[model samples]
Target: MLNFKNIAIRRGNRLLFSKASFIIHKGQKIGLTGANGVGKSSFFALLRGELHSDEGEFSMPPNLEIAHVAQETPALDCTAIDYVLDGDRELRQLQQQLAAAEQAQDGLKQAELHGNLDHIGGYTAQARASRLLNGLGFSTAQEIHPVSSFSGGWRMRLNLAQALMCRSDVLLLDEPTNHLDLDAVIWLQDWLGRYPGTLLLISHDRDFLDAITDHIVHIEQNNAEIYTGNYSDFERMRAEKLSQQQSAFEKQQREIAHIQSFVDRFKAKASKAKQAQSRIKSLERMEIIAQAHVDSPFNFRFPAPKKLPNPLLKIEDADIGYGDKVVIKNASLSITPGDRIGLLGPNGAGKSSLIKVLSGQMRQLNGELHSAESLNIGYFAQHQLEQLRLDESPLWHLQKLDKQASEKDLRNFLGGFDFRGDKVNDPIGPFSGGEKARLVLALLVYQNPNLLLLDEPTNHLDLEMRHALSVALQEYEGALVVVSHDRHLLRSVTDQLLLVANGKLQVFDGDLDDYRLWLAENKKTGDEPAPAAIASPAVRKDERKLEAKRRNTLKPFMDAVKKSEALVDKLQQQQIELESKLADPSLYQEENKESLKTLLAEKSRIDNALHQAEDNWMVAEENLQQAEKSCIN
Candidate 1:
């Protein structure tokens, strides 16, 4: 058991929480939740002995084995499975001792060590490590790969696996699902449910917390309060408490207002001065109730698209993949104006490939893809965050998109995403992942695209931002197709689920719960048979020839489209500059009359040129589409 008595903690000069008292009992799974930088991680540090309370007392069982995922993984040549096995320090120590005993030819010592190994299940440690690796989305083949070979995100998964491999009395996991897919998240959820230990988890994923935790310790306003139930229950209880708080605050305000009014009316008269003084004393004696504040900082909506084509995009008998390697074969999907789709699949199942094809970021290897002329895609993927100019500000990015938009309007829009004040103008290079993700999302939302294809949109977002996004998506009129590990977001925002597996894109027959069951069954049965062998050499040769011919035929039309687009962009920029000059009040003064007239004339000329350029762009785009159709036919 862990007990805290009026604990006060500080990070530098900032007081995180004070007078925090709670008892975390054995075998209890508690979720620590709060806004970012609200001392949840600091609390974990306290448990790990990296920090000490500034006041009062905190106590835990002595020598309690606690396991936590490492934040950084050093590059190592050791195989992944071996690295995970190292989590069991006792098992490793026993093995080393037994090996030394064998080298020394100490038969008696060897026998004693073997008995101890059997008692601790050391013989099966390797198999246990492998299971942890597999459950965290690693393939049997990847288990042999060196730790140094894995990417950063995969390394994080390995760290998680290693932490789970430990047979500890207590476990601490923070944002365990951030780097995982839905299938792996489900697997970890099940694993944690079966873990015979006290678990303290810090996660922004509400569904994960609900599935794994029995109690919630919420930190807010420099206070930590333990609730009796899961995340949903805590939300309900908090809402009710806040409501009562609001009522009391309102009642207090009314009483104060009444007393103030009486004092103002009576204080001027000599006879009523004493009564007014008594009223003032009563007002001073009354305690002020703080107003309830439970509002999310994020509150933005997708602007309505300029045009809503019925079928925004369509794919028929398409094969999506890199050159000669097919990831998704014979895929057929139609996205209309209001389709809400959530994609589900195991890691590396080509869900992202399909999204890329739909977004026109990748060309189909075979078959037809027809996009409406009015289709405006607001595609968001994790990589796009990296594409943002780190040296620039959020306002700069928005102004680049629409220089004609007023600064006030742009700032107001950014404020909805919580990028207000000087923060909007600050360089984003030093921003955290969540801030970068919010900026990416803010840019996407400002585009007013008819189709939204998001790949793991909630990866770095907090609970408040996630809730705000879910609410905004609910009110969105555009078609949304998202691939996210967040089950709560999926359940709230998507009406249909699509399963991507076995090189096929098909509508899932059931919801997320059914999908979870399917994953378990599929694991038992093994992966769907490997995608059918590649086409014959002669057939491949012919397909390559056809692809080359199509590319050759579309080159001129594509070039024309690009040229027209550039011209339109150039003209719009010029127009924006001219309009900006015209907007200055100083330019309208007598001394600047001639300059204003010239600016207005230039603006008129640029507007005409921009209109012509826009028309040319449409013509070129139409020609390109027709050429593509011809090639398809």
Candidate 2:
């Protein structure tokens, strides 16, 4: 158990939180939330013993093993899988000792070290690390890739995998899902749900918090308060408290007004002067109740487009990808006025590819792409943040967009996004990622485009800003196509769901719940199957017949099994070749150490891939056998 007693913390003369008292019982999942610069990260630092509280005390069990994601990962010439496995310090130590024992030809010590390795599950460490990589959306081929080969976001994912690899009593994760897609986010949710440890998570994702956390620790007004419920429950409870506070404040204001009025009327009269003075004293002694502040700092809406085209954009039999590699093919889509679409798929499954094709950022490899003569597009992607003029202010950017607009008007518009006073004139170079994201959104919204194409727009947005964006999208009178990991935004804004998977684009007939089921099935099958479209009564009957048709139903499953088996066979053969090279005596020389390391890493990745492929094959075969039995019955 971790206990905090009247804790007070200050950073650079700014008191962040004071009188914070809370006890985190064993295995409690607490969602830590506050606005930016609210010391949430500082509290985490205090917990990790990197910083000490200015006053009060916090204590936890001395022997508890704490794990946290590293903020930075140095570029190292090591395989990603090996880096993840290194998280288990004890296992790495054992491996080191084992290697030395073998080098020394000490049979007894080698045998003892092997026993220790088995005891710690060191033999399966690579497989465990590989699973973590796969769950976080790394492809099989990428597992053996060098750590330095990945981009920053992928490096963050590697950091997350390393944290999860630790065997700890307490886990701390800050913005764990920022770089994940919807599918990977769902996978991480499941993984955290099964984690047998106390968790302190700091994230701006409301649905994610509600799904995984049982309690919320909110820091505001120099106080950290604990609430007994999920994020939704906490909101409800906080709203009620604030409502009561507002009522009390209003009643107190009425009394003060009455007292002041009486005092003004009686102060001129000698007889009532004493009574007025007594009332004044009473008024001074009464505690003033502050008004409730429920408003978000962000308040803005998308301006309606000037023109509404019947069909804003259309794609006919399009092939989308880069160079010669096709990510999605044979896709037909039509976007008209008032269309709201949310794309759903696993990472690298072509969600962004479709968006790129639609936005004209990437030309279609094949097919006809059409747009209205007067169509205007507002495209938002992560790279756009880097395109902003860092040396210029928000006001300058807005002025550049419209030279004739009044400065006061532009400042008012920027204030809606919380860029008030000096912030409006401050150079954007020092702005946080979230601020830059807000600025990009402000620019996009100001454009008033008939078609909005957004890719992961909520990546750095806070909860309040996300809410404002959702509200704005709900009121938007134009077509929208968005890809985001934020389920809350997707549920609130999107009216249609399009899935980008299996090199095809299709309308999903169901909601997010049904999408989850589809994802589970896809994971089991090792190949994505098209979801059945919404059916009429006659069509439903035909669908039943289709399922019962043994040959038709069993063929896909058999094919999947064969595909997985062939993949396993191919990987195993490569594994054999790598092992033969590794077995050569010359390969163990000092000059060949790097090559040996690469080969061993490849061998580990292949072993893990073969195991997964075999498991997939087994699942496919079992499903086929069950379908055949059903037909016979």
Candidate 3:
């Protein structure tokens, strides 16, 4: 168990939270949450022994194994799986010792070490690491690549995979889902639910926290308090506590009434069947959760668009991707003034590519894309954060958008996003990601665009800011297309779900829960196929027969593909184990010359087998793809 007795934490002279008293018992999953800069990371540092409390005492079991995702991943030549396997320090140590014993020709020592390895399940370590990689959205082909070959975001996933590989007593995860896609986030959520250890997670994703954590430690007003149950429960308890304050009660009532008004206005509209139902549900939730955010520093909304175009943009039989390489084929979509769409698919399935196409950041390779002359697009993506003029203040950024607007007006607008006082004039060069994201959002909201394209807009936002964004989106009059792993935001804001998978774009006739079930079924089939779009009555009979025939003809190819994949996986595991043994310096010693030769010979044979297995897998995959294409044609 871990205990914090009246703990006070300070960063420089700023006291983030004091008088934090809590006991995190073993095997309990705890969520650490607060506004950005409220020292949640500092709390994690304290747990990892990188920082000490300014006052009071903190205690934990001695020799406790703590695992955390590394902030940086070094560019190394080691294979990704090997990098993950390095997380199991004990297993690595045992392998090293066993190697030394083998070199010494000490049969007894070798036997004992082998027994220890088996006891700790070291023999299956590679398979375990592969599962972690696969679950995190790394393909089998990518797993064999060197670490240096990956981009920064992929490397962060490697770091997360490494952290998860450790069989530690306590796990500390800070925004583990930030670098993940929705599918990967769901996978990680399930994985954490099964983790047999104490988990301290700091995440801004409400649904993620609600799903994984049983307790919440919330920091506010220089105080840290623990609440039993998940994040939703914490919100309820905190709302009740805050309601006791008259000012908070007034704010809460206003917020509830505001949402109630929206509900009442739309609840009777037949045209808003889905959206009205969603808002009604949100209204019910706001009654319980609104008071919890009464003191939130953020409160902003998107201004009404200058023009409400019937169809802001339209795509007809379009192909979107980098030049000459189509990622999404024959896609068709129409965005009107009030369409709210959420894109869902596996990672690398071109959701962002489609967003880029719609935003005109990239041109569609084929077909027609029509946009109304009045269509003003407000596009938000992670890359846009870098596009912000770092040396400029929020006021300056806003001024660039509306040079005619007065300083006082711009300042008031910025204040809604929590940029007040000197912060409006201060250079944003040193601002946190969350602050920068808010500034970007502020700039976007100021434009009053008729179309909003948001790709993971909540990436760096905190719970309060996310809540604010969600509420603001509900009031937005423009069309919105969002790609986010935050299910709560998606549920709150998006009325339509679009599936981008298997090189196709189609409507998903289900909610997030249905998407979760679809993902499970897709995984079971080892194919990232999206649900078939609803067929017209005229074509349904023919399509059903064709689909059945396609399945029958594709079965042999799919079976062969799965078989080759299994073979490749088995050989890869063997290769990884052999490589681990070969990495020992003692293996090169002259005294163990014969043993080294035998190991080298075994390595050569395994390498040959692995290469053949990989070639066969490639052939099988090619055959499957060809068959799929043929069937489609």
Among all candidates shown, the one with the greatest TM-score = 3
Any idea how many clashes model 3 has? 0
Model 3 vs. true fold: TM: 0.90
**Of 2 and 3, the candidate ranking higher by lDDT:** 3
In terms of lDDT, the poorest run of 10 residues in model 2 is: 284-293
Distance from true location, Cα of 347 in model 2, Å = 1.6
Which candidate achieves the best lDDT against the true structure?
3
Q: What 10-residue stretch in candidate 3 is worst by lDDT?
A: 270-279
lDDT of 3: 0.87
TM-score of each: 0.76, 0.79, 0.90
Q: Give one clash count per candidate, in the order shown.
A: 0, 0, 0
Q: Which stretches of candidate 3 lie over 4 Å from their true place?
A: 270-280, 542-546, 549-554, 561-633
Model 3, 567-589: lDDT tens digits are 87797678667666765667766
Ranking by TM-score: 3, 2, 1
